[model samples]
Target: MTTDTAAQDAAMPTQPATPQSRAIKEGKFGKVIRTIVMSVVAIAFLYPILALLLAPTRTEHSMSLGGIAVGSLSNVQFAWAQIVGFDNGMFLQWFSNTLIMVVGGAVLAIILSIPSGYAMARLRFSGRNALIFATLLLMVMPNTVLTIPLFLEVSAVHLLNSFWPLILIFGFYPFGVYLSFIHFKTALPMELVEAGRMDGLSESGIFFRIAVPLARQAVALVGFFGFVAGWTNFFLPYVLLPQTQSSTLAVGLLQMISSSQLINPEEGLNVQLYMPELALAAVVTMLPVMAIFIAAQRYLQRGAMVGAVKG
Candidate 1:
């Protein structure tokens, strides 16, 4: 072809016949397929949550009927009243206990992690490598494995049957330690510390001023995980604080379910009381986790993979 014709052809954009490219260009079949697949996956994950949310609003009769229809607001109000009224406002007490424990654990974990991780990452200390290795092992090991040992320790210390054990145990999250360590090791710039040092800042001053702000993403990540772990923890609190009145939501829910059946004059035994109220408790317990996850989404997405791969 002529030189001008070839130049024009080279300057023009080219389109490929790949399915994704064609889908974007034409906006049809491939988009439809992807949309359908995502919709199916979304429903698969969400339907269970939807059912749980709906349960508190439902009655034995409506739940047994097997339809998608929502129940009246009165049923929701009834379930709420029942939960709050159970054992004379025990639910509120349990909720307050849980909040205190969760906040204490999360804050302590973050506070300890920031310094410990920074030391492990920046300072030359004995057993640093061993500590990192231990943190990794603890992070991977199922929490149940530590329960027996932790129980023994707590019992020996006379901290059992109290909130301190729950708060302290949950606060000592090795995963948070490891996350902060990895973040500092991989993402932290040593030049900043040196720069601070040159400017007459002590190690503590450098860490507090330079390192902390740069590590906010890691802090959010660790704090979110710590909070969730503490919130959902069941076996530890159940075993540690055996008192019914001192139960957190997870243990409280378990207690409610275990004692679900009730005897009546008209009926020999029934589980009707367990259904709606238990469902309501479960939903209420999970709300904080959902809220935190949503609020921390930006930091989570940004920092989740920060230290996963080498820089």
Candidate 2:
């Protein structure tokens, strides 16, 4: 009887490992691997920004030797003094130019894009689809491709080497229009618009009273993106503004760094901007955009999720 029972037990096959059991065993290992890879990627991205932040607090010689160690605040003050003293205070001029262009362009873009998008989404006009298509085409087109043509157009209008040209070009934001159009079409309730119309509100009245109020997220998104674009615009400003003092920070900073002893050590220019000063300038350039992003972070998040759902 014992021999027969042993033979039967041997004949029976062991239960195969189910998918749930396998997943339970492998999930912990997968999580560990993912965590390690993400950590490595995060470090890789942060290292450069860390180095940039630290560079302004240390002298060029110390930076070359000390890697990314924190240094004294006095070094930062010295760097700022060097930046302020350069080119009869051209850094301040560049900063003011960047500020005006970015703010003006972003505000103009918001004003134009909101109404245009509302018209496209709600109004029954002729050639509306064609207009939307053109906007999409322009949105996909690279800004670099339009640089030469824009320069020529600006020159034709006698607006070259001026702030108006940069502000106008930055204000022509097709992507913002598209984003607004999508938000209105997908996220906004048509019933509210109909109710406004039924209540004797004109198209403009309905737009201002109903559409704009509800589309705050979209507006914020457009404004933020427009500000960033205008703030970081280097090529257009570089091409249009030939004078150094007239240049925005994006163009001026690069020119300053490249012409100084930091980049061209052999050049006989007496300007002695080193890595620390240049790094400080770069940090200063980035601060406004960073502050804007941090302030509008919640709005941006809500805006991004606006048209994600159907209804």
Candidate 3:
């Protein structure tokens, strides 16, 4: 009887080992496949940026290869030209203007969103659920779809030429509000909020002190995304801001490449193929977001992964 019992136990254990081993092997294989796919996708996305950064053997485009002498594509020369072309500090002005738009817009968006999200997620208020649902729905709609209405609204206010129009429009990111709302609702515990209240904190006080403090990672997440959106915004700024005073780097780059005088062949130009100025502008535009990401990658990564559900 003892021998039979031992034999039964050993056979049962060994029988299950095969499936367990197979599952682990399959999991590792799946991870390897995912890694390979992601690596390929990343490389494909980065290839164009790499090619643009690298100096070609000759500075000629296939579009008009027959036009001019092949020259070296020098980053310094192009950037310098972009910096001081047409006796104008155009790039510098655009850089400063973009700084104002991006920073001001992002700061305003975060300032409004954090409290609004906290209130919706934690506080009992009239129309809270309705508002959040409306926000999510509105956010899913393309910004382009709202452009004409927004333009008319800005025009009605007579602030079209001023940076205020663009600033105000971009500063209201419903998506950020939703993201923060979901994050705080799920990741933050009710106990912490209740504790703050028990300690005699006001509703507003509890939000500023406890909720926000605990939800810093998610705030950073919203801030980064909002910043990127504002930074790379094209249509609103291009449409609202007048050509002379408030144009951003994007609009300025377009004008630089479009003006017939700038691309004149008298200066031995190959304007259609490549504008080193535009290339430099592209690099300049991308650098800040890249720097921000590189600097705060750790916190940014955490914030992006805040997979919390909204109550």
Residue-wise lDDT of candidate 3 within 205-229, one digit each (tens)? 9988888888877677777888888
What is the TM-score of candidate 1? 0.83
Q: What lDDT does each candidate get?
A: 0.80, 0.86, 0.72
- lDDT by residue (40-98, candidate 1, tens digit) is 99999988878888888888678777654588889998888877766777778889999
Give per-model TM-scores.
0.83, 0.87, 0.76
Off by over 4 Å in 2: 1-25, 266-271, 301-311
Number of the predicted model whose lDDT against the real structure is largest: 2
**Per-residue lDDT value at 15 in model 2:** 59
Specify the poorest-scoring 10-residue window by lDDT in model 1.
262-271
Model 2 error, position 141 (Å) = 1.2
The numbered model that scores best in TM-score is 2
Superposed Cα deviation of residue 177, candidate 3 (Å): 0.6
Q: Compute the lDDT for candidate 1.
A: 0.80
Residue runs of model 1 more than 4 Å from their true location after superposition: 1-35, 262-272, 302-311
Model 3 off-target regions past 4 Å?
Answer: 1-43, 55-75, 260-274, 297-311
lDDT of 2: 0.86
